[model samples]
Target: MGRKHLEEITLLRGLAIIGVVAIHSHPPPLSLGFLGLNKLYIEELSKFSVPLFIFISGLVLTFRYTGETIVYTDFLKRRFEKILIPYLAWSGIYLLYRYLYKSETFSLFAIAKKFLIGSAYFHLYYVFLILQFYLLFPLFLRLIQRFKNRKTALLSIAAALNLIFIAFYESTLLIPERLPRRIFIFWIFYFILGAVIGGDLKNNKRSAADKISYKLLIPLFAASLIYLLAPAGLPLGSKLDVFWLMKKTFFYAALFILLSYKLASESNFPTHNIALKPITSLGKYSLGIYLAHLIILEPLSTIILNRNLLFILTLSIAWFFTKTVSNLPYGHLLVGKINNSDT
Candidate 1:
């Protein structure tokens, strides 16, 4: 199936990028007033950004490859040239930042090893996650080909795997250091969901239930909120409360589906609306912005002297900066794709 311009995905990506900024940017110091609630709400909203991005990656890949004959070597080659190149470039950028600006010292060999593991920067774990998915892609496609008609069953199995992994993570069974918490198994469901959705779209056999709506989401959101309303100070970890991850994974997937359904609709969505265009552009450049934002945030924190103002200013800078970088030669090697020539 040939790909169309899915602005809705870009819109979601744009939203997710901002949500990430919100997560990293310091919120206004919580107050005794409703400001406290506001902060918590922002945190809850931002929790889904990482998962949504992973989901989109799975969706795009599955959408592209489901029915077509896939060349495994070609796929990996494309992934390496397109994704790994930029990943390494940005990784080196962050390592240099740490060494020079932050005054952290480490051997070149150690830095190389850290890059492999995605410890170069706090946010680079995402690249590691995607690499995991890429490594597993051919296998995923083989399974899909074998179980060509068993999408729901495959999805169910993947969901079960995710839950079981969570249970193990939360159990007394020691999670090995090599298999870190951010491993692909922990978020397998999203990738599987994407494959199922993508294949379904290709087959043109979409399920009505999968077409989420506001009616389905509102009650689900309420239940999720209640389930996740733990005390603010509760120690959170995979071991402590796997339900936190469970709730976030389910709720955000549902919410994203609902939002995508809406934005993907015909009449109400002004795809070219002037006001919304910047956000869509931001979404297009999200990868670069994701990589480069930390560099700016570091300096901005000290000079700005105000958290809220600093957050907005840094995002504005990062957005334009990322856009500029993406336009230069070899930019796609850095930021994935430019999305459009106009972009």
Candidate 2:
């Protein structure tokens, strides 16, 4: 059976998924007067997609492992069975579609190699990275739980490692191929940070003050930093790597959780509102929406983005399709833990 329903958890999951979709949609510029400026803002904000998902996954993992000692092997197996397997399955399905529809040529041997090594394109990188994080989280968790004084030290190490990885890759240090050490370097920090925060929360009281510090100040600081530094036509190089982004994105994710909690606690953002209910409803099946929408967006962009009205119309159609598919049984297979019956 699932744990007690946390509206805050699901709502945040939904919000994070939509943030990801925004990244994918790469929506046309809003009329923010400065057209170029607005497009830049939307694009940068969309980059939060991966960071947001990682942050939430970290938070959830930490919450699960708190104070309870378990075998690392078992933990890894369970996580892989649930998340990695599904990712591989979906990746294969998408890969086949790409081969057939996009005229992307691939030998059978290459397909096997890409699948086994996770060297495919688009969001498959996240699938591979998450698996790496799951493998590393246990040892990382043990360290944080053992050495309470090492939080700042740990953060610095993560920062330094992030910088090293970025310098080499020109992107975040990812396992660009099937190299184990390189991949390990790329993803370990987020896993550790999540586990540390989870462990910390066990004794760390959440007073109003702590909430303000972590939830509000941290995100505001991150936003200010991004605004100051990230400008138009930025290539999102190593500076946007997992380690560097996590420091701020973790704050943003924490803020999202805190805000959602407070909002739910006070019934601030009510489902009673007619307009938001649809968005939230879509959010309910966000994983389904997420996994399926990419198949639509890539092709639609080639056609619809040429015209503003067509783009809007295409988005509406895509949203309708996503919502429809999410309502189906297959949708449950996408989000992992969510139960569609509740809706």
Candidate 3:
């Protein structure tokens, strides 16, 4: 039910990880120029990165664990141990970094509240989002197993539910802006659709329709690019919103992954081709870099480093730091995986 090792997925992960970093690598205050364009394009490419990550997680988890009898408690325990420990460690690290380096102060109780909500820093919300998905993995598995035959309907329902939530949440029913973000309703569609894709793969049911979807992707991608390139000064009355972009992002990621699968099959390129080795390695350590790269950015922001050069340096340092730390004793507690042994 699992995908045999595929090099293209790793390459996609490498792209996604760099996209993530690029979103954060804004240039220093100056006039708009090539550096500004760099930031804009990188941000556009990265808009789908988080959703892609979530989709990948759903796809891989469903592919690997669909038929296994899930002991919910034990499964959650094992999964959370790998993820929550690193989340908590990094949360605390960021909290201290804020207090010591920025000369900010907060009460212990305040910090605890911030930690619970993943509000200790900007990027930590993804941790909570992923953790919530893990907490509900058992339900997800059951849904996928039972509804694999009706995947289109299942995915359609999820999309409808998400859109309904967006419609209401964006209007004045007073659900409170922050509540929806912390809940899973906003993202269920992507995750469920990912499971559908994975389940189909597990069932060995590739069809010509898959190729049709790939062909359909080119126009969809162009439309998305046009939307991004459009002027941004419109008022809130404009119908285009983040949710619209999100819907497009879902399909963009979906079609891209399908195309990648098709291409991966066609290419006879060695998985460890010299050009791909570093990217695959970076993908392997994406988690640690995602957690720690903000620290690297703080100093870089103050200095006059070229944004492109800074990005490369940060990627290298983050990968090196993660690799070295993950080899040390108790490293798994801090970084989610051990590097000294075969994982």
Give the per-residue lDDT digits (tens) of candidate 3, residues 32-60: 36665555555555666666667667766
Q: Which residues of candidate 1, in runs, are more than 4 Å off? A: 1-3, 27-38, 172-179, 207-213, 233-250, 257-270, 340-343
Backbone clashes in model 2, listed as residue pairs? none
Ranking, lDDT, top scorer first: 1, 3, 2
Clash statistics: count for each candidate: 0, 0, 0
Model 2 has an lDDT value of 0.55
lDDT, candidate 2, 263-334, per-residue tens: 543464544457566556655555555555677667777776543344344445555765665467865355
* Whole-model alpha-carbon lDDT for candidate 3: 0.68
Instruction: Determine the backbone clash count of candidate 2.
Output: 0
lDDT of 1 by residue, 1-343 (tens): 4334445667767777887788777543335255655555556556667777776777677767776777888888977776678789888988889889989988879888878988888788888888889989878877766766777688778878887876666564566534554599888877777666656555665532356566876777666556444443344333333233553445555555545545553334445768888777778788888888888988888888655677698789988887787788977777777543111
Worst 10-residue lDDT window, candidate 2? 334-343
Query: Each model's TM-score, in the order given?
Result: 0.85, 0.71, 0.85
How much does candidate 2 score in TM-score? 0.71
lDDT of 2 at 3: 32
